[model samples]
Target: MSRETIVLDHLGGHEAAARLIGGRLEDVLIDGAAPRVGTIYRAIADRPVKGQGGMFLRTPDGPAFLRQVRGLAPGQALLVQVTGQAEPGKALPVTQKLLFKSRYAIVTPGAPGLNISRAIRDDDRRDVLMQIARSEMDGGDLGLILRSSCAEGDDDAIAEDIRAMVDLAAAVVADAAGDAEVLTQGDGPHQMAWREWTAPADVITEAGGFEAEGVLDQIALLGVAHVPLSGGASMYVEPTRALIAVDVNTGGDTSPAAGHKANIAAARELPRQLRLRGLGGQITLDLAPMAKKDRRQFEDALRAAFRQDTGETALVGWTPLGHYELQRKRDRAPLEVPQ
Candidate 1:
């Protein structure tokens, strides 16, 4: 497979967008924006509301909520990391735990031990990386997950990356404990895409005056009514308040075989569509109506296609009405939402 590409589009003002490989809009970030997911902040606990269970915390980005307020009181300072952004009418979600990510590993403070990425399926290789983590961590509480990229680097480079992450985490903790209101700024999507991808990506910007790039135009497709597929079929994709819904239409084909082929094509496109649009949470697919046996066959094909996704996905089986249920964990907001 070819390595993914990253496109950095800087719209006028503070706004910017990062499109990952496959023309998928990954994330949009802004300068001086509200605390985003993975952002760390210094939070001062406030008095609990009369009936509210979680206490409000005064953070640099704004107020956040600590759901389990045990042992925390007003005027107490705490280090918190942003778990999720503030949704419409919802406050930002934060946690006391913290994590640091580098090219090779993810370092988690206040967590125990080390884990190897499941992508490193070779048992012998897993054992070697595990031993390296154990030896380098040296009984520290910082946890490490050797990312798949670790396989590309030798022990010395991996150890250096881990040590750098550990040091960065320690510095963040110290900063959060100090008088500074802001602990550390989170990485923008452009920087993050570069770090996460296996190969380097060319960064483009509107500021560069590149008129031929259709990336900005493609952003509008996130809200497109339907996407045409081969075999005269199309997939209807829309995001509801609850979840994303996809409907497969055998546009011009009526034969049983045609419908089956369209279903297979839709299944193949679903993963790319989801990633491209950055749509997550629960996704329900309304496949073309078919017999029980055909539906089973379609389900198997869909499951096989979904396996290609890196995100955690669950095939929740098909409904009697021919609706196929599945869910993908939300890493970021849908592309339709402004960053």
Candidate 2:
């Protein structure tokens, strides 16, 4: 019953997508101009690492990391998909496993065969959709993964989506005529979010728009020294070159029960804050001093909230210093550098 909205801000030479839940910025996607992830390019395989399973690919966007596979060879022309944006001095990540995404599903050239969405609880409906996917694929080498949206669609609709994806893949392969070229342009952040969450309430681009202004203000708040949580507590979020650290403070609530309550409150909002800021990689949460029972309760709240995130986030265990460790896959560059 949560009301969600998507806002696209294209101002000051930046394009970003902010997803708001109950008028709060829950998740944001930043769209960059060039060399974005999801773009497909034709590249030449560079030298391969002997022991390591990675190789360099000479692409139009620059050299990228390619996972060494059986068919990949040095100096050979290969088609690759950008997996992640390049960091300050690092190269972009690319993979040979080409994939085309549709509204209902994603088509892959890899060996994943067919996978129905786990969100669909009805076994009979899932089996029916799987059969439809298989029939549409027709024993081809292409693989298909029905997205969560597929649960709302019928078999015929799913089949049509698969066909469209397959056709689009064929068109992209045909367009890859040169040694190094961009075959398919990647979707902007707004488009990507729309596909993931379905059409939003409204998409505003004007600089002075109300929703746009609100999202911008929220982003600015994300840069402040401390983030306000319930129970009058605050969190100090700091991102380092190696990892991100968050320290929870009770703001003068010195009682043990108060500290434990503050930590639990912060735990509930930490995941949403992390996604809003697009802070990925290793994260260390410095919890308030609490008993073992309180720690377990705090962790439970943290995991439950993080489960709503689209990213593959994992709770890595607590540190010797009572800090909880978390790891999230790096999908793109940080939306804003920590101040």
Top model by lDDT, which number? 2
lDDT of 2 by residue, 1-339 (tens): 347777776634566677776787777777665577788988888888678788888888778887756767787887889876665777678887788987787988756588877888998888888878878886567788998788777667778889998888777766654687878878777678767767336555556553443776777787764888887898888889988989998887777697898888888888777776667889998877788777778888888988877777899988888889999877766666324
- Cα RMSD (angstroms) for every candidate in the order listed: 4.1, 2.9
| Segments in model 2 whose C-alpha atoms lie over 4 Å from true places | 68-71, 154-157, 173-178, 199-213, 337-339
Q: How much lDDT does each candidate structure score?
A: 0.72, 0.77
Over 4 Å off in model 1, which ranges? Answer: 1-4, 12-34, 46-56, 66-76, 122-135, 154-156, 175-180, 199-214, 312-314, 336-339
Tens-digit lDDT track of model 1 for 1-339: 333445554544444545455544443443335565678878898777556678888876667887867888888888888875465566678888788987888998888678888878888878888888987786667778899987666888888888888888878766655542876777776566555655545566546421245555565665585888899999998888888899888998988787778888999888877866667778888887666678777878888887877556788886777788897865555555333
What's the true lDDT of residue 172 in model 1? 78
Q: What residue pairs are clashing in model 2? A: none
- Give the 10-residue window scoring lowest on summed lDDT in candidate 2: 204-213
Per-candidate total of colliding backbone pairs: 0, 0
Evaluate model 2: give its TM-score: 0.88
